[model samples]
Target: MPPQPSLSFTLPSIHDNTKLDCRIYQPYHSNPSNPSIPPYSSSSDPSWPRHAAVVAHPYAPLGGSYDDPVVHLVASTLLDLGFVVATFNFRGASSSSGRTSWTSKPERADYMSVTGFLVYYMHYLTAPQNHARSIEEDNNSPPILLFAGYSYGAMVTLQLPPIDSFLSHFASPATHTAFADIRLRAQHLAEEQSTMSADPASPRKSLGMRFGGDEDLSPRSRGKHRAHSPDPEEKIRRGVKDILSRSKFIHRRHHSPSADRGTERNIEVPCLENVDNLIRFRPAYLLVSPPLGFVTNLATMSFSNLWPKKRKDGRTKNLEDYTKREESEVETEAKLTANPTLVIYGDHDSFLSIRKMRDWATKLSNVEGSRFRYVEVLTAGHFWIEHGVSQELREAVYSFSAGLVKS
Candidate 1:
């Protein structure tokens, strides 16, 4: 294959009627420009694609999305290597809901939803279903599903906790209520900020002044600055005013808490949603995905150290910062050692670490005495450059996935 094949579509993510724009690449068919993409029989019964590999993007707050060249490259790489690839944005990222937060519950749900969607589309056709057909292949199909992502995306994947225990977390009144509240807050926050900024009397400058510090910024940027100098209320008023003037801009650009874009909201809140999530994961692939730096901080910070510790009187110990976390540092045993998992951590991954990535592959995920795969691409940073990863690096991805398919 020249590269592999890939395709995009809008699929239902949040609800049935509302669709999330998604791109599903054909399994391992990289060369879209090729004379022949994989031939699909037009019969009402077409073939079922591979029942594996849901690909997610890195941190959306930091410009990561299903469409990023880096994440898609991996999707295409896996597609070429013979796996069904599904890529999408976190709810607030490209097009999915709520806000992009460290505890990416909706995002993870987005990933899980792909598995159900692919399986339904491909298999439902055989009996009383849609036009999708099962691809002619051997019968010993395994229900094995593979989930993976890069950087922020990887952290999202590792968040996949056990189904049973995880469900209870959602069922708890407090956690469920908190999640609903968070979702509502995100929506209103997006709206309130927008409405406040649209006033005709709003200042002439862009709110870039609030996030602004670098005087070296271009004139165009400075022109957009909401306040060149500020009073605190004026700054807030200007930013809220700016938000109103541009809803779409704010929805896509604004990050949470700080309300600034490009910030990664990976810190787990002590809220029911996050504490439950941290408590439930396999803990094996915790720091597996590469570009080591990107993962390590998230992993190390993942400790109870990030959360506020409590004392015997049921009062929580005070942290220097008002921000508090709920989870106490707890011992976690590895869960994924039994499932063969392949992880790819790019050396350039800034959010997470590569050493942790290799360690994950060789130890935790693979350590369960399961089949393991590792790739350290040379001359390649986090995202494989458009120029292309070095041939050696390219081979590692393809070769490893190919072996994965065979094994």
Candidate 2:
């Protein structure tokens, strides 16, 4: 089958103000008239098929982006299985702004921003129109969010905080904040999409036309604005309003050349709501060729022993801080274990030895009540470029996703 159509847009990183290029692909069978493809759920049906997936590419410094073939393969598989798949560039990748960081914290925040946006977008699109009725009443089943990554991206995915903790950051963001801005953007786009789904022949505006202006601004110009612009909050609000106004004009001016002009539908900027009740997702995980050992540590600059020695008076404070960090890590690990997790690697992998990978996988799978699982292809390598390994990878992903749908 041919590739499915996708919506191209940019999302701001909560870490910095840099924009990350992103795309969201709806399933091929979303159209009502496409009888060749088996229908999973009606596009207009606001209740079922609330499954969404985010696929992350490999290392950014090594030329990985949303267009990576491995990323494409996984995303395509999920899309075929009725998932609204999302793929995005990390900072320093492709047209996204900013340089990659050594500590990896900023990258983790970037991932969080995208995930949060997807969660809100899904909620808005699937939510019932009746505000009085509970959203859960329309759909008895909760939404499923699959977080999948490859190579360095997989490592970053594993280190992410639990779903609840991550969603808490966006629960009730203050007005004029970056989190608030993200929620606004997601709602606007979701409204546009819902409209299009109702009338498939509508003339759609590109995200660039809708959210223009800043894309042409140089990084130096942005830096200057940050340095000199007082009232940055007001500036952000004005920018959003200006973009919407420009989009309205563009839509009217380019309405039609051969047919009678009609009144354009007013674009409603959705009001922000307390999203805590709207977001209730069951999380699943998929890791493809996740790196391990010393190389991973060096790339992330994670040296535990590099901390400065504490004074005798501060020893207790230092110990308390360490304990808190350890507990946070343990909490994240426990969440991963409780979810449906799958790690796929190759025995002939180049970056990490088979022995170390086997040991890590075995240890995780052996945890009490753990749902973690793994698949190690005998002759495949890190890239899965071997003759038949790509097929194996696809099959494994298909089976995992099929299980999610059935359950």
Candidate 3:
């Protein structure tokens, strides 16, 4: 059977920004109206925009959704602790609106939009109950905004500036320049992609000459024709096209703007191939700059990556791209809060090896000092909670998260 999709709903947000559609995967019993509710439910409330923690789904376009097991585990855990836990799709995320692109500045805006809207909606529907307050008055409310995510979502949560401070700063026209750097970087990348494509030796450009860019690569008739020449010698051809496309896709996803700005400097990944040629890699420190710049740099590098174009030939000058990706990953991971964080990676995960994941996490923990957490599930390929994970694993998740939620 196919998987069930998440439930979708629209909420009006602050500043009259676009009304956002979010996929809200709520716990079955959090609402008391349903007795069949499990232990992790607070279902009795009839209030609108229930008191809950918001789970920001990881890289939604990359098969990560509100229903992803890691996200579900987190959301479900919070729900059982008596919080109305809901995970929403970021715009361009699965079922969410807008074009599919990971622009950090814009995505962060969307996240705050969700936070603002939820706070306002809850206040409007249930007066005298304020769920959000200026950071100065953060403790004044209960069931406060708890934004959580795995990989990219983690970055989003970490990168969120103090909303009240940001709003206050915005009242003055002088501070608008804070957003300019990201805009400039994006423009630079766009220009770079176009210029790089112009190089005559580029394999893509070379292919364009023979096939006629109009035949496949050109904006017109793009994706209209297959590149494989179906001649009798077809068996002689290899699967280069397919493999190259997949590789390109991963690199492209990292180029998204959403994953590249603000407090999004802290990136959470299941695993990393930490050793290369037996040299262990260290996570880079991101505290070298002001919070905004530090976060922006970390964010830019976390979710997006520059593609390393390696032809079947022995040459590889994409060293610049490789260096950039490494720096980005290290800084983001290293910049995590001193409060211990749990980094979980599956052994069987195709993305990277357990050793690599461990090495990166170890180095990151070193940066954050004693306040670091790491977890690895063996025989699990990027998803232990699926076939490989047992009930014990689920219980462990509950036990761990339960410590964070107050009854």
Query: Best candidate per lDDT, number?
Result: 2
Residue 390's lDDT within candidate 2 is 96
lDDT of 1 by residue, 210-309 (tens): 2112223477875665355454333434544453344321111222454576655543322222211111111113122433343434533434456777
Q: Report lDDT per candidate.
A: 0.44, 0.73, 0.41
Candidate 1 regions with alpha-carbon error over 4 angstroms: 1-19, 27-39, 42-49, 128-139, 162-335, 346-361, 365-368, 386-390
Residue pairs of candidate 2 with colliding backbone atoms? none
What are the clash counts of all predictions, listed in order? Answer: 47, 0, 23
Candidate 2: 10-residue stretch with minimal lDDT: 248-257
All candidates: TM-score: 0.53, 0.77, 0.47
Best by TM-score: 2
Q: What is the lDDT of residue 362 in candidate 3?
A: 75
Please identify model 2 stretches exceeding 4 Å from their true place: 1-5, 30-43, 46-48, 129-139, 203-272, 302-329
lDDT of model 2 at residue 78?
A: 87
lDDT of 2 by residue, 75-184 (tens): 88887777888888999998888988887888888888989989887877755443523544466556579999999889889888887887776776643456766776
